[model samples]
Target chain A: MSINAYLAVGLGSAMGSVLRYSVSLASMVMLGTHFPWGTLLVNVLGSCLIGWLAATASRAPHGKLAHWQPLLVAGFCGGFTTFSLFSLETLHLAQQGSMGLALLYGIGSLPLCVFSAWMGERLAFSHPPAA
Target chain B: MGHGITSVLLVALGGALGGIGRFAISNAMAHALGKAFPWGTLCVNASGALLAGWLLGVYGVANTQSLWLFAVAGLLGGYTTVSSFSLQTLELWQRGQAIRAALNMVATLLLGIAMTALGWWLAQG
Candidate 1:
């Protein structure tokens, strides 16, 4: 990565992280602590946005937007979601064709996603994520 | 930060910082790991869940005021992600990477929860 790359990621990380915080906080307040509405909402929203960005990037494929490409792609999406890793490791298993591992993991994630949020709230709402 | 202009500015700044941080980290992970699976995404989500839990637990006993909220919840949590988690799982399904898809979903979800619990447990202790 060049200096531009570093700057782009830096800029994107700051904005993405802060925006996520604000929205999620608002969601928590507007919603409730019983569930992890904030995380759920942020995760979903961020994913959709990234999907759109990816599509857009593919289509145009040029300009300052392109310059902002990595920033948005690696930086924003990176900031916004860990989807890359999810895709990577899962795919790694897929290539190996470890049906059992893959299938079991996929099924297990359902509760996990909920539980993570639940625990987050439980920690925060019930106890909190420590100082 | 007040609920007025200052709060708005603070919110913006925090979002900007978090956004950039997320982008930077994800990029680094993607590069370091490679482009086959999504080690980047998993790590980010896992870390975020862990940190959020830790911070929340601490805030309960100590101070996680609005500013702290802006920093930790907004900045770090925001910089990290969960959305990518959902999307990637869906993408795997689309590509017919069934086993990997399933594993991806399960591992992230289960691991994420476990991590959150671990973080909380550590904080509480």
Candidate 2:
């Protein structure tokens, strides 16, 4: 409810959104737009990052990473991975009579993202490399 | 200022505003509905998808690339998040609420796509 929280989220979101835009443009150039590889990539990466950050923050409640949860987890991850675009892309695919692809895209994304998040959490909980 | 820079600035501005709006709405929904099921994220994603569909329907993708970048990619993208959805589903499963987790995933995907289709239909008519 504080102004600081809003500012943190806003700034983080700007950075994340810009990164997403760059990735989308790059993916479009490299892979073409037949499939939304860019959105899927971002969503998977963002979910993994959020899972790691959330797990790390939870492990140490008052740690430095916890302090930046609003910015990094909520703002950056939220802005970087978009559900709206995913939904629209699926809809467009279906509209274009690519129903199988639409169904696959819509149904496939959830489990993949969740698995990525789970893997990220496992990575966080795993012991750090010998230092 | 070049076209690329201008587009980036627009996206940044839209993203910032959209993120703030999402934060406010999420907090409000959590407060109002309690945090048992992540109703906030579902609401945000569904609504954002609807808006994105409507915008695309109204403007068409080929004609307004800049507006698409600003509003759909920036604003709606910032507003609607798969990461939160994925994390929440994983948490639900970890907590042994498998049914709730499944429900959340199905509800979000169905509602989002349905809303997007509805928005497009409405815009067309």
Candidate 3:
């Protein structure tokens, strides 16, 4: 990777980590630490954003957007979307008389996300008829 | 063990980078292939899982304090994502691709655990 790439990843990672922590803390305080909304929010939002970027940005030729994708998707998204928080949340939910909720959350989250991914790809891959 | 300023900070930092990382990978793949499936995400999550399994097991077995904290807890834990995988599988099943989805789940869990064991053995050896 080039220096620019490294810099992009590092900077995005730093920011992403900070956001993950902040949201988790906030969620823990308000929603309670038992389950992790922070990870859920981050993953769900990350999927949507990634889907949108896939749909909209790929059609255009590479230029400024080329560099931007790494910073946002690879760096920030990679850093932000974590499985650890997912495990913690599920454990907490199970412990808190919400075993079913935890299971559903764990089971349902990724597939729901796949739909978003597919939709994004479909939208992006498809083009308007010679407008 | 829970609720520390440092841990919280790490999560946020990890999240931002992870989010961006996903964006970069998926978008790039989408652009290159001109396809409708999420090859990027699968690549990212699967690769991340392999690396994490290796990393987590190495540190866990070796009992290396530094590795345990930095590599295992901070890096690996921050890297791989069960959430994305879970969400992906659900979508597949919902779309009536139940077989593929089930296989994906089973494969991920089994292979991930096996890789973790491999890493542990390698580290201990």
Candidate 4:
């Protein structure tokens, strides 16, 4: 990839990270941090978006939007949904003696995210083919 | 500049660098290990979580909000991705590699949390 590709990914990551930070702050104020609702929300949303974008791209390999894959799919969605934080949060909960909650969190997030991505892919594929 | 703006700028800068780093590492991993499995993402997420946990132990989340924002929330967040993991798992399942897909999901979650805990423990001592 060229330097331009790096630049696009970086810019997209910056934007996505900022959005994630904002949502985390908001979630803290509204829902409290006892559970990482913010991370879950972003992960689910990002998974869906990535799935949709990936499906769309597969359908149109040489479409005009192909160039945006690095920025949107890899950078934006990747930055927006963080596995590290999820892991750290789970560890924190376990350390705090909330083993059950931690177990629930660790076990729960995967299926939710996968299902969301599948739903997004289904949505994309279900649409009528472009002319 | 306002405090909030400064914080955001720090996060943006960290995120940009982290994203580039992730992209480079991912590309290298894919080339070396092949894309049959998402070893790239798994490595990134596990290492990122370990780093985040170490930082938390060193800085203490309550004390260094700014540093935490830049390093953990921005850098690690940008480096480690759940979206790619999810999409990859779905693809694996679609390809009829249900066992591999399940293995990827379970391994990632388990390894990530375990690595984080290990990092925290190491940092504490």
Q: Number of the top candidate by DockQ? A: 2
- The true-versus-predicted C-alpha distance at residue B110 of model 2, in Å, is 0.3
Q: Is candidate 2 or candidate 3 better by TM-score?
A: 2
Candidate 2: regions farther than 4 A off: A129-131
Q: List TM-score per model, in order.
A: 0.65, 0.96, 0.58, 0.96
Write one digit per residue (lDDT tens) for candidate 1, span B28-124.
Answer: 8888888567777677767766765565556642223566546554465545565555555656655778687778766776776566556656888
Q: What is the interface RMSD of each candidate, in Å?
A: 8.2, 0.7, 5.1, 0.8
Task: Name the candidate, 1 or 2, with the larger TM-score value.
Answer: 2
Listed in order, the DockQ scores are 0.19, 0.87, 0.25, 0.84
Q: What is the TM-score of chain A alone in each candidate?
A: 0.58, 0.94, 0.76, 0.93
Q: lDDT at A76 for candidate 1?
A: 64
For model 4, residues A78-98, the per-residue Cα lDDT tens digits are 888898889888888888999
TM-score, B chain alone, candidates in order: 0.80, 0.94, 0.64, 0.95
Candidate 4 lDDT over residue span B1-125, tens digit each? 25888889878877887888888889899999999999999999889989988986887665237888788878989999999999999999999999999999999988998889888888999
Q: Lowest summed lDDT over 10 consecutive residues: which window, candidate 2 chain B?
A: B56-65
Per-residue alpha-carbon lDDT of model 2 for A1-131, expressed as tens digits?
88999999999988888899889888998999888899999999999999898888888888888888889977899889899889988998888899999999999998899999999899898955221
The sequence of per-residue lDDT tens digits that candidate 1 reaches over residues A8-74 is 7656655665555466557668985433445445555555565555444445566455557656755
